[model samples]
Target: MFADGLFILFTVFAVVGAAGLVLFKHPMNGAMSFVVTLIALAGLYALLNAKLIFAIQLIVYAGAIMSLIIFIIMFLNIQEEDLPAEEGRFKYLIGGVIVVAPVGMLLTKAVNSLPGSEATIAGAGFGGVKEVGVKLFTEWLLPFEIVSILLLVSLVGAVVLAGKRGTNK
Candidate 1:
């Protein structure tokens, strides 16, 4: 009963935070909402017994990523003018459908599936930190490196966006 309650609470927090991120006019508030969503997701991960994922979600997203975002926002001195206005016309309805479609499809498919859900996810190769480390370093190493490279590119993009341009004079 307590778990169920916590689940509901966290899920509400997650949804509301996501909505706030999209609906908020301010970039800083959106970032803060994203943080709330990430933290709630981390809580969900912990509840599911995926301790490593919980830690990673918190450490990577809430800690490192949010810190980076806050730093960038502070450095850039974001104001009302810097933030983009929300798109026009039935955006909420459109956004609701966009978010619901894949999720509803996935849920429908899962409800129909006989093989996947019955198989215990907890026991399966969710393993732990050591197993995860081995796979991340060995099997997924190339993809991991590629992702890092992409992140580096994004970092460069952010730098270019924030930095003052050279004068033509």
Candidate 2:
């Protein structure tokens, strides 16, 4: 019962945060709202007993990614005057909802139709950091390394572009 309540609370928070992210006019405000969503998702992962995922959600997404987003936003130094008037934004939002509502309903129905399974206790070391580390290093090493390299390349490219922009100013 406690877990269920917490789940509901987290779900509500996540939804509210997502809505705030979408509805906020300023990029910084939206980014802050996104942080709330990410943190709520981490709480949900904790409720699911996914400790590593919870930590990653907080650390990688809420911490690192959000900081990077905020940094970029700050670097851009956006002002209210710089923002373009968003005419017909509400119309676009309504149109988007109209297009997406059926897909949402279909997905909900599909999930509800799935077979229910008995709750089973996980084995020892299941979802533990060490076990996940071993699997990630052994089974998923190549893909992981490729992703790391890709991130490094992107980081370097961003730095180069930023440097070029600075020099141009």
Candidate 3:
């Protein structure tokens, strides 16, 4: 019962946070909402007994990633005039809903059509840090390295762009 309640609560938090992330006008507010969502996801991971995932979700996503985003926002010192004015926002939103609704329905239908069964208990070492580390370093090694390099390149690009903008101004 407690687990079920926690699941419901965290799921609500995640959904509401995601909505806030999308709907908030200010970038800071959106980033905060994303942090909330990430934290809720960590809670869900904890509930599922994925302790390593829970820790990673909190530390890597909510802590490191959010800090980076907030740092960038603060460094940029964005003002109201910096944002582009949106015209026909309501019309665009309605059009987006029209486009997304059918896709959402189809995905829902596909999920519902899947064979439903009770989840079996995970064996020893499942979701453990050691197993995860081994898999990440072995099977997923190339993709993992590629992702790290991409992140590094993106970070450098962002710094260069910010520097250019500062110099231009």
Candidate 4:
């Protein structure tokens, strides 16, 4: 009962966080909302006994990635005057709603039509840290290393671009 309640609470938090992330005008506010979403997702993972995923969500995404983003934002020293003024923001929002609503309804309908599973419980060692570690280091190793390299390249590129911009000024 308590777990179910927490699950619902976390779900609500996740949805609200996601909405806030998209709706907030300020980039910092959006980033903070994204952090909230990540944390809520970690809670959901915990509820499902996915401890490894929960930890990675918290440490890697919420902690390291968000910190890096915030640092870049600060380093850029963006001001309100630097942002381009938007015309008819309301019209854009309405258009977004129009495009999203039908897609949302279609997804809901498709999910509802899927056959229900009989298993209520996860099988033994499901989402266990050891199993996940083994799989990550073995089968998923190439993609994992590729992603790391990509992130490193992106970081270096950001630094180089920022340096060039600073020197140009």
Best by lDDT: 2
In model 3, what are the clashing residue pairs, if there are any? none
Clashes of each: 0, 0, 0, 0
Report residue 11 deviation for candidate 2 (angstroms).
0.4
Q: Itemize residue pairs with steric clashes in candidate 4.
A: none
Clashing pairs in 2: none
Model 1, residue 18: displacement in angstroms?
Answer: 0.3
Q: Which residue pairs in candidate 1 collide?
A: none
Q: Which stretches of candidate 1 lie over 4 Å from their true place?
A: 81-121, 124-126, 148-169
RMSD for all candidates, in order, please.
Answer: 4.0, 1.8, 2.6, 2.5
lDDT of 1 by residue, 1-169 (tens): 7877888988999999998887777778989998999999998987787778999999999999898998888889987877665566357758788999999999999888756553245865574788788989999999999999999999899878766577443
Question: Which candidate leads the pack in TM-score?
Answer: 2
- Candidate 1 local distance difference test against the native: 0.85
Tell me the lDDT of candidate 4: 0.89
Ranking by lDDT: 2, 3, 4, 1
Candidates 2 and 3 compared by TM-score, better number = 2
Please give the lDDT score at residue 13 for candidate 2. 93
CA-RMSD of model 3? 2.6
1-169 per-residue lDDT for model 4 (tens digits): 8988999999999999998987777788888998899999999999888988999999999999999999978888888877557667678888999999999999999999999975388768878899898999999999999999999999899889767866747
The runs of at least 3 residues in candidate 2 whose Cα sits more than 4 Å from the true structure, single-residue gaps closed, are: 165-169
Give one digit per residue, the lDDT tens place, for model 2 in 1-169: 8988999999999999999998888989999998999999999998877889999999999999899899989999999988777888788888988999999999999999999966677777777799889999999999999999999999999889777865746
What's each prediction's TM-score?
0.69, 0.92, 0.83, 0.84
